[model samples]
Target: MASGTEIPAETVAGRKGALSTVISIDAMGGDRGPAAVVAGLVLSAAELPDARFILHGDQAVLSPLLARAPTLAGRVDLRHAERVVTMEDKPSQVMRHGQGTSMFSTIDAVKNGEAPVAVSCGNTGALMAVAMLRLRKLPGVNRPAIACYWPSRNPSGLNVMLDVGADIKAEAADLLQFAAMGTSYARNSLGLARPRVGLLNVGTEEHKGRAELHQAYAQMSAAASAGEFDFVGFVEGSDIPSDRVDVIVTDGFTGNVALKTGEGTAKLISGFLREALGSTLLARLGALLAMGALKRLQARADPRRANGGVFLGLNGTVIKSHGSADATGIAAAVRLAHQLARADLANRIAARVASTGLAGQDAAATGAEAGTAE
Candidate 1:
């Protein structure tokens, strides 16, 4: 069992009414191809026994790998494809030319109800674009956002952030959409009620923002007043550590930078610790004294926990992990996908939007003449 502090108090309550979770994984879509993802699928399968697995990729490429791991072969159904989308390809190019690509096939399967969730560590851009264009919105959403669950220093509940690396050039309306979408995500996925919403601005001041920022701020402010959400105002990147808010909102570009910066920082610190502990026996002894503390810190910093990113607002669940993610990362992603499917994120989001009667219109949110979101 995980240490009490290492787990959330809500885990038990959250697992009360679990749903049937099935996932389709892009078996050969990441930087390392099928090897790492297949290993992760096997690991996740053992952990999530109820999660049926369909591994989509080039049969020839994956068959040999699975032949070596016969145990995995018996568990996973092989879904064959021809082409593979590369890491360096343009989003549009990959979507159009990367026909029969594992990522596309996996997403298609999830959308078609072959599975409840799809996990990909491949071309993130293509995954988001394809999920949006294909699965479309889940009833009341305008644009789908990338949702990452953040572990807080408080350890009470996981914070959710969105729009990471999707629309860097997003406008105010887009940010507001992200906020609403995030609110829905927090409620549906994390089971947080009246989840706190925050705008990731430079400062907490109402006036602190860019041109688009000002517009988005005003819109979200009105939404809060209208009782649409529990909007908590602007938040700085520094506030991510504390449990000040349940959802941090921003545009795709800004959110991506924040997410990458956080990831890089974690890597840098971990590397520094390894190097420090390796150099001398004296330092190693010092590390040993603090091994428990170090494990706790490292566990908190582990990318595996944050590896899964939800493509919020989609008709179906699509998860994106880091482009360089390996087997361990992929395994965590499948677990997260299972968690999301069990939570029924899409349906919850739809219900929240419907209850607000806002549905597709947040015009009044824009502080405009109550027109479109713009």
Candidate 2:
């Protein structure tokens, strides 16, 4: 219903409370479908006493899982939608004729105010397309970006990265907006007075890539000078986890690769250590003594903290977990959404967009009003 057809407002509505908002989940959207989603829901209920869920999917397919995970069924309500959009479903098809699908309905719940956020693990492209089409943008936002949280080496806090496969090709202005948007997120959610923002570039130089880098460099520098954020210049992939920067901005394609590579490396390292320790008696004894340390490291290495991606720059809060997310992973995403909604992330972003003159008009508009203070 949100369209660029209308002019951007000078001010957007304030954020609602997390406890005041409900989470709508598509139980049949992931690799394991309702079973895994149900397990996650049950865990979520225990962790979040105030936040509830509205499961949108085929009740017939979910009934058995519902019985198995009685706690979730008892706590959360259900809304049936006879159809589901699978991982393999064509995005174009979903974009073309997926009106009655459960994923759409789940999102519709948020649009209708029945839920504050929507979480799903199915058809990334379809979800992004649908959300963009339905929720629209926050005035100045060109294309909605996806953000994922990375657990820093320092456990005290986490780092955030955005455009993780949302927009493969990004404009310089878009990246700058993304950085500003990201900074606002860190400040609002992590309680930072001035969040450090970094552009994902090959090097820390002012001029890096061919045209794209040069263009983005100018915009980012200007935003920083304008006091939009504590812009920390360019950061390489290696710098993402060093905790040197609070927000790392990149295009979706590169961000997605980096995300997947990080996960793959973690798994590889864990497996390698397991095999190496089992190969010798001394190593086995060492492993026994260091089991707790190993487990802790493994947990730290996990990308799940960064696994659940947030669709930033949208009108409403929508968190998207990995398409192959497990029960615990999904639970974590729900919890993060709870925190974000409670943190008033949407309202904060809206305010930033309004104050900084970001959300001036939906790009789709041919003649949206312009030239305002915010």
Candidate 3:
């Protein structure tokens, strides 16, 4: 039996009855531990007036934390798990012996229909492994991808990019599926009716990029109509944050590198701006005059505002929050998860893939064979 006090059956009945949208959370997964997770829940509760949470972690550790957070008294359902998956734990080991861990318990809640979404700041690999094992992949999804929001110049102020570290490699068909999934995400999350998707390449020219990208380009182009998205052929790295495309599709290797590089560049630029502003009295005076604009810029460019990465192609929606996320970052992730859940994100992606026929078994098999041959 789980040790923590379970929210009453009547209180936790349906997603819409007592709670708005319940999100299962791995309280023990983050670097800041359960305290930060509980704090995040308090923050999220204020932001999402209708949101509820199922927090899974060690009872002894979490009980005290919850007692300290009186605001979350009836809003959270606590599930006790004795073990935790450390950052050092390998995905393979977790998959083999993950039954009693908090991460597994968190995913299992979504798997069992207790919640529509699962959020974790745990080991990405282990979390993905447990999710795939418990929730399994959505039908017609060959290789699941991790899609994240990128601060962009678009009207919506964000662009969706996928495979941001779920798997290092993506075949042509996989990339095609990523496009469909990303388009679904953009449509649902950003309220875009027909999202423009661009395959990531060295250049925008159709002739550029390797064989797989070319193949993906052709496949996405053909399926654009059925997928209800506009395929913009190829998009270069510079176009990622541009308003030209709503979704950027690429393999995990390139996407992860780009994601990290962009984050590092943002930090570097912010540091440079701070140093330059403080270097001279004149610059400091100028900064003080533009303080409001600078604050707006800071808020607009804050990575914490776009923290969660949605694990696409899963049977249940799973959000991977950054492991080092603090209370604000965790709350941001939880908010994103709740937004996606309210939008019925999982069903939208599945329906898009199924209707497009891009996820057919033959296409996946062919792409897998081609990837191996390469």
Candidates' RMSD to native = 8.4, 7.5, 8.4
The lDDT for every candidate, in the order shown, is 0.72, 0.73, 0.84
TM-score of 3: 0.90
Error of 2 at 42 (Å): 1.2
Residue 34 lDDT in candidate 2: 78
lDDT of 1 by residue, 143-165 (tens): 67888877775454478888887
Off by over 4 Å in 2: 1-19, 154-157, 225-228, 357-374
- lDDT-superior candidate, 1 or 3: 3
Cα TM-score per model = 0.84, 0.86, 0.90
Residue pairs with backbone atoms closer than 3 Å in model 2 (clashes): 139-359, 140-359, 149-306, 165-252
Model 2 per-residue lDDT tens digits across residues 53-104: 7888888988878887766654567889988898888777887888878888
Residue 191 accuracy (lDDT) in model 3: 67
RMSD of 3: 8.4
Candidate 3: where are CA atoms >4 Å away?
1-19, 356-374
Better of 1 and 2 by lDDT: 2
Q: Best candidate, lDDT-wise?
A: 3
- Arrange candidates by lDDT, descending: 3, 2, 1
